[model samples]
Target: MTATPHLNTEHPKHNLTGFIIFLCSESVIFLAFFSGFALLKTAALNWLPPGVEGLEWRTPLLNTVVLISSSGTIWLAERCMSKGNLMGFRAFWLLTMALGAYFLYGQAVEWSGLQFGFTSGVFGGTFYLLTGFHGLHVATGVFLMGLMLVKSFIPQNYAGGEQGVQATSLFWHFVDVIWIILFVLLYVWQRS
Candidate 1:
């Protein structure tokens, strides 16, 4: 019999580099949207549609705090996973998911109370487009975290699933960072 060829057994512990490239591509799309918003803000004489004063910051600021806190909780989960603390990982991971869900709920409440719709004008269109897109990403992150939590129940997955864990954490962190930028653009800067 011919000798078997040696197999490559070495593999990366995580696909962080690939994931980062993916995030970069996502950043391009968000950058385009933000650029469009800035252009409209500068060119339009009346940034707020007639009769619309401006957005209230209270609810959104609270939601921002909740969403930003998720980044910390997720980071803690990653730290726990790296240290072989599965229980800690699960606890923090679940907490992160809860925070994301709360943010989504808060967004929904705010959207419901809005006096405008997508067809209202440029202000309304951009507002819904940006926040809705970001909200979708947050929902996706929560769903992924739920899957990871279910997988964590399996001991085999816990021992050898660092790549998935790391990728999810990276995605969650990227979403949080994007929200920060969006919050500044849509809420703080526009109001000013």
Candidate 2:
């Protein structure tokens, strides 16, 4: 006789669906800003504007490396969780958080060195608005990861599937992808 395994308590599948809906809504918000920025850039006499000749691109590029690397670290962390290696999971996850913090710090340092104000012109305004919103998202992602990190230490909290880690990973990857687009538009294309 073949033995059939009994089902455990049903883990909610709706969490993934809810997160997808949230992502779609957030996509609309980003799309609006992107479209507006494109329109404004085309209409303006000068996209760079006065007092903002060139952004110090090197620092942001390095920060981009750090931020993008966090995505990889988080992926490894998830892998660790799947393998039931809590120590490996925590180490990689904490490394991801630290990289995120470094990226934010680099952004602050770059902004401090810049000569333009928010009111400088359209370029300055859009620059800050777009990047600022993205930064806010990164911050939120980091905070969420921090909470997950704390919960992970609890034996019960991590016994189930890594739903929280998965969600945070998706969000963090999205944030990093957005930054790549912004970096190209704001730094690379603008330079040319």
Candidate 3:
């Protein structure tokens, strides 16, 4: 007779702790980017990105609101999931997805206003490098959230959707926080 291996069926297979820790490491990466952004901005020579002209205020302000609101909606989604409220989770995730789309759309509008494209100069280089990286983060957040939204509709006995929900929330919130730091450093501080 051959010996058989046993499965640990007593616990959930999803690893929330590991996912949260991964998010924390990503937070540190954004922190370093913020520090570099602060230094480069303050040390600028003759002109800023648009040549002595600085970044716009109104658009970024609107984008900030969009991203922050999405974070809030995602938080609400997580709460709903914890309570086993599938309807609430689906509604919240849908709203969050819409807001995420809006934020990216807002960024595209702002990019259109940028006088210099990627080839402009130092300002173009640094501005695009940092903000573009952040935009990628936002895109990932949307994709992950969308995945969770789809998972919500599946039959019972699903185990990992909650983990995805929390991870996406952490990532979306991180994106919002990073933009706050970037906007302050790149636009506001450069002027005054």
In the order shown, the candidates' Cα RMSDs to the true structure are 3.7, 6.3, 3.6
Question: lDDT per residue, candidate 1, 108-175, as tens digits?
Answer: 99999999999988999999999999999999999999998998998687776588788899999899
Q: Quick one: best lDDT, which candidate?
A: 1
Order of quality (lDDT): 1, 2, 3
- Residue pairs with clashing backbones, model 1: none
Per-residue alpha-carbon lDDT of candidate 3 for residues 1-192, written as tens digits (9 for 90 to 100): 354545434233356677677878888877787777666656767445445467788988888888888888988988888888889988998999999889899989999877787766666777887789899998998898888778777787244356567767877888888888888777777663
Query: How many clashes in each candidate?
Result: 0, 0, 0
What residue pairs are clashing in model 2?
Answer: none
> What's the lDDT for residue 109 in model 2?
91
Q: Which ten residues in a row have the lowest lDDT in candidate 1?
A: 5-14
Better of 1 and 3 by lDDT: 1
On residues 72-179, what C-alpha lDDT tens digit does candidate 2 reach at each position? Answer: 999999999899899999999999999998988998898888898787888889889988999999899989999999998786887766677888999999999899
Which regions in candidate 1 have their CA more than 4 angstroms from the true location?
A: 1-14
In candidate 3, what residue range of length 10 has the lowest lDDT sum? 4-13
